[model samples]
Target chain A: MKKLVLRLRDLPPSAWIFFAWLVTLSVLPFLIILAMSFAVRSESGLISWTFTLANYERAFHLVYLKVLAKTIFLSLGATITCLLVGFPVAYYLARATPEKRQMGLMLLFIPFWTNFILRIYGIVSIFGNHGLLNQTIMRLGLTDSPIEILYTRFGIYLGLVYNYLPFLVVPIFSALEKFDLSLREAAMDLGANRWQTFTRVLLPNVREGIAIGSLFVFIPMMGEYVIPDILGGAKEVFLGRVMVEQFFTMQDWPFGSALASVLSMGLMIAVWVRMRFEQRKAGPTSHGLR
Target chain B: MGDQRILKVLLNGMLAIILIGGAGFWFARKSNDSAQPVLRICAWSNYLPQNVLTQFQKQTGIRVELSFVSSNEELFAKLKAGATGFDLIQPSDYMSRQMIRLGMLRELDHGQLKNLGNLMEDVRSPAWDPGLKYTVPFSWGTTGLVINTAKVPLSPGEIPGWGMLFESPDPKRTSLLDDMREVFSAMLIWKGSTPNERNHQKLEETLAGLRNIRENILMFTSEPRQYLARSELNISHAYSMDALQAAEMKPEFKYFIPREGAVRWADNFAIPTSAKHVAEAYRFLDFILDAKVASELALKGHFSTQNQPAWDLLPEAEKNNPVLYPDQATKARLYYLEDLGDLLVLMNRMWAELKI
Candidate 1:
């Protein structure tokens, strides 16, 4: 036993620390949730230990399917908007002088200093009927009545895109900064047009950065309730809202777990596909030396 | 090299101890708060007046701490998830019933509550708690309508019933509650059905009615006070406290219980089974039960007091406000929401469908 202790002490502390985190933070909790998804909810709305497939059965209803489809559509719309807006911002930021880059980066991160919910609430006041925007519009005589922007799907899209634009920008910016300037010249020297150079060479190189950044925003977006709840005026039922209602309003823990498990499984499959794509891109050369 | 490594390890060990000791000292300062008992109560936001809490602390020499919840379901979620630190919790009528049925509440010791006689006789035995066994009624309110008369083009006397909600000149300027039970109760009352509706056929009709109004409603929000203040919402389905307080502040916005009637909910104080400071909890309860404190609470919160003595202490102008203390005819229209038992699943399912 003493030798075992001494051997354990001899091993690197970081390795054991990471192992501890893996078990406590990720693996154990996931296993528990997976087990709970199959559990039964008593008539009292509390969980019982008995196993049942009723939660999954209920989760597969048309209502949940509609919610899932809406959530995916909203998230996809936000991600696409982020990409369109982020590319130009990232290019300017990456190509700027040191001081300008620093200032630009500072501007990008300033919104993050405040609480996420507080920032969303700030959006509410700006777009609300009695808000600054509407007041300005009326003064300018843009229209007779206030344009109804608040509590609409358009407002939710603006919020999701606004919050996540920086996340997508930073990564693509880093990739652009590392890009070789002469590559464009080389492509031009080989008679490639500007559009071809951008599409063929630049985009392919930055696609990884884009994928990683999109996933960073997309995963969290799938679980977002506050932005839609506040900015969307608690209308347009999303998956996260349904999941929360299951636990709090409905008091159905088993059903909530079942919904969560399905979402997590979908996310894991996405991550697995990403990893496989990267592995195929890397090919077998890296392992040949071993 | 070995000697150097040992010296480094010793230095790090001392640093770790100092860091941990600092954290311990910081926490110990909070735990070492004198010999005075600490009473913790979790209640709805703005329910417990600061002055009352201060007076109780001064009289009993017990320190008080407070946490707040926005809804009864939130309170239930917290306690049911193994939150045991609170000595007392405030639950609404239906939630109190649900908790009592589940044996999650501690029975009241009538001997400790000396000021119990201050409560109205009618509230002495509610349907949820027979013989005042588990809960003490705090305040009663009605889910009613608040209309901005300046924009709505209607006099306070001319305000129609629930029909005005759907049939308003600009229904787009209105909002309904995000709460399933409240919205459903409003619809049930409008359709001349019981609030805690169980018949699936009637509920189906109610669901269809909600879907029709779903387009008319600008949004679904439990808290519409901010919107009403900004005149963003001309007509809103609001709680009595929010509407009454807004009416008092802005006379242009009139609040009234619709003739179609509405859901009447009461907040109550009940000790959880996991209470640690039971004696201190009783002392705090008796303090609030005092007629003087109860009247102050009602006056400040804009909710109707359950204490009869408190009602007597109120000003004549307030005592006669039909909105606050409704006339017998209006009172006859109010319905109390109860635990719907197994039918809650159906209620939630229908609510989800309506949202979709």
Candidate 2:
């Protein structure tokens, strides 16, 4: 025990300090949330000291399960949409001259610098029933009636895609920027066509970047309450909204914590799956290269 | 080395400075702790004017510290989090009742509040707090509909009651309050049932009705005034104060309590059981209850005051504004929300189902 203490003290101060801070800030709060999830709520909505699995039992009910499924579906849709729309933009920016590339990246990040809620409100105004789209259409004699765009599934998709497109673009762009040009040349030299060479060479190289970008987009979208609340008109319930209602409106902290715990577990499983897939794909390729 | 000696000297100087500063801070805090009475108030933002607070501080040497909460649930949560140093808190009628039941509030000494009689008779002994034992009514308002006259040109007679919301020619332009109780109550009132109806069959009927109208609703939001102002939403279920504010921005807008009736709410001032400066809290409550001060606060907040003398002092235009002071028939129609206790779970479930 004395030797262990002395050895721990001998370690670099910065390393131990950072480890302590991480444990305190992140791990401690998570542990507390886990503990709270097992507790019971009193008649007046206060958390009781007694432990129970009733909160978790209630969380897995059919209604809540449906909400969770919808949340996952929405997030997946957003992630795929972002990847599709972001790839071409990222490709163009990556292939641009350094000066042009910097400008393109700046333009991409400019929208993000603005307040998120303000940007959402701006979207609301643009897609609203008597919004700019309908007004423009009317002025151009295209249609007499205003086009209904806001407060629909389409509106939510637009908001999610617009908000998360940059997350996908930035990571994929960086990956493309680091790509070895010789690999593409070699694929072509081996009698591969443009499409074939691109598929065989370019796609695999950027798989990690795509995975990282998809995770960045998907995780936050799964817990998104604001965009759906503002843009989708609170017509549907999502996991984030359900959790918020439980915590704030219902004042049921244990149930909210249980919902949050399940969500975190789902997220962990998703991350693990992705990591395993990446490892399996990388293993054979790395060995072949060596 | 000379550099090593300089570094040691610098470290000693820094240590001395920190120790001295820490001592000074501790001494200052200790001195201030006993110097003056500090009254901590937790309430909704803009509920009390800064000038009124300043006046109270000047008159009584008590320093006032204010914290704001957007909702009553937040107030309850703050107290439940080990009774934060809140000498006074503002809770709506139903919430006050819940807090009282939970033994979270301190019963008021009516003798300490000299101006208690200034309150209107109706609110003097409200159902939530009979005999004004736990709370004093601060501000009151009704939850109703705000219509953009430009888009919704129909006369009041043409579109009467909550039915107008569901049966509108352009239902796509209508919005409902995002609040669960308010939305459910609106639907109930439209069905010619009491807003607080608890029958399972009736609730199911209400849920079906909401689902039917779901496609027609433009959105559910608390702050639909912006949408209403922009003509994005033609009609919305909103609070009378918010509706009036929206109408002030656009003269064409109108606020009307549907013929069927609506939720009449009153926010109240109460002292928590954990309050330390009960005397200061009483003084502050009494100061705000003064007829002139009450009138000023009412005008600034743009909500009705239960102070009868304050009502008498209002301008004829404000006094005659039907939206601010509804006629007797409308008043008869208005209902107060009761604390449903365990039954709230039912309401929450129905609310979730409605949104889903």
Candidate 3:
């Protein structure tokens, strides 16, 4: 035990410091939120600490359950959309000549320089009733009336894809950069077709990236408010909007907090399952390395 | 090894202190007074004239802070996050009642408000807060249609009514406010059920009428001023203030309270129960109620004044604007929103259903 203490004492200062701070700052909030999940709200819209399972039970009601299910479904659709659209672009950027790769990556990042709300607002200017898109279509004699594209489910879907595609692209691009060309070449050299090489060699190699990107888009999409709020008009009602109405219009904090806690638990379970899967996959290779 | 270990231990201890101390200080500083008491006033972005705030700061020692929220929902979130330390808040009539029911508002002493008498007699002792118990009436406006005479010219003496919004051949040619209550109330009025009616059949009829309007609406927006100014819309079911704002920007724009009547709303100022500087909040409220300040607010925000004396202070050109002061008959037809209680849940759900 003395030797163990001495050895630990011999370790670098920065590493110890980083670990301590990470635990206190990053980990503490989640614990607080978890603890808060058990609490209840008073008539004053303020939360009170009383250990009760009522909030969780209330969260399971049909209205909220349906909302949660819809949120998950929407997130799944967004994730799949990002993957289908992002993977090829990521691949193209990764395999491009060195000079072109920088430009492609810059194009992905340029949108980030603007305020997010402004970008969403910019969509209105382009798609509003007398907006340029409709004006152009009219000038070209495509139709007599302006196309109704501003306040529909399709508009919301388009906005989500436009906003989150970068998140998916950046990660997969990073993964593809470190991808070993020889693995794909070896598969091809051994009579494997392009599709076989991609599935067997490329997919496994970039699994971490895909997982990271999915988590990035999926988690936020579940709690997404602004995109749907602006583009969806009244057509697409999501969980976030429902939560806002509950808290503000209905003045039901207990119910809103309950809904929030359930959503948090759902997200935590999703992350834990993903991490467990990744850990299981890593175990055999880590043992081989040892 | 022993000497190296001691050195490393010393370094580790120092590191731990730095990490823990930094976080502790960060949180401490966050809680600590930044020497500026942030007074978060949740109102429309263009509602409060900055000049008035600056004048208030000069008169008093307190630094005024402001946050603009497009909807009451956003404002509600800030109020719920108690750590935000907002001293004052502005909410609409029904929202004020909801907040008061939830005990979010501080019980105001009318004695502190010197300009309380400056408010119109009718606006005082409102049903929501009888005898000015919790909130001070800030700015009032009626929800109605703003017509662009250039696109859909009114006949020689014709004014645009609510029916004009639905009667156009192209259903996707008009605009409406995105607010559920306003949109729903307008539909209720059009259906001939009183906006305050609690009957189930009335609600269903209103809901059905709204569904049709929803189909007809090109897009619903909170900021109708933008749509009107750009001519993005021919006619919009808009707040009187927003219509006045559009008229100021473009003279061709004309605003009218529809023949079916419209919902009148008053955005009010109140100190929250958690206000640290209640005196300053009261002073601020009273300052806005002053005749000069009221007129200045009218000029800036383009909302009508409830302070009757402020109307005389304005120039004849400004006073003559019908949107600023609709005639007696128009005023009689309008209704202000009152608390709906549990029925709000049904209304909200119906709105969601319509959107879907």
- What are the per-model C-alpha RMSD values against the true structure? 3.8, 3.9, 5.4
Q: Judged by DockQ cut-offs, is candidate 2 incorrect, acceptable, medium or high? A: acceptable
Specify the CAPRI tier of model 3. acceptable
lDDT of 2 by residue, B172-226 (tens): 8888998888888998988888878978899889989998999888889988888
For model 1 the local lDDT of residue B257 reads: 89
* Model 2 agreement with the true structure over A159-225: per-residue lDDT tens digits: 9999989988989999888888788888788888999867778887887788788889989898889
Alpha-carbon runs more than 4 Å astray in model 3: A1-74, A126-148, A248-250, A271-290, B1-44, B53-80, B83-89, B95-115, B159-161, B164-169, B271-286, B315-323, B327-329
Best by TM-score: 1
Clash pairs, candidate 2, are none
Provide DockQ values for all models, in the order shown: 0.48, 0.47, 0.28
Tens digit per residue, CA lDDT, model 3, A1-290: 99978866766665566766888986776566567667876544456888887767766756566667776777788789999999999999999999999999999989889999999989888886578899999999999977878777677777888889999998999999889898778788888999888887888888889989988888888788788877766446678777676666555566566677677777789789978887777865532111
Q: Go through the candidates in order and give each one's C-alpha lDDT.
A: 0.85, 0.85, 0.77
Query: Across the candidates, what are chain A's individual TM-scores?
Result: 0.91, 0.91, 0.85
| Candidate 1 collision pairs | none
Candidate 3 pairs with clashing backbones: A234-B355
Question: Predictions ranked by lDDT, top down?
Answer: 1, 2, 3
- Worst ten-residue run, lDDT, model 2 chain A? A281-290
Compute the lDDT of residue B200 as modeled in candidate 1: 95
For lDDT, candidate 2 versus 3, the one ahead is 2
State the fnat of candidate 3 relative to the true structure.
Answer: 0.33
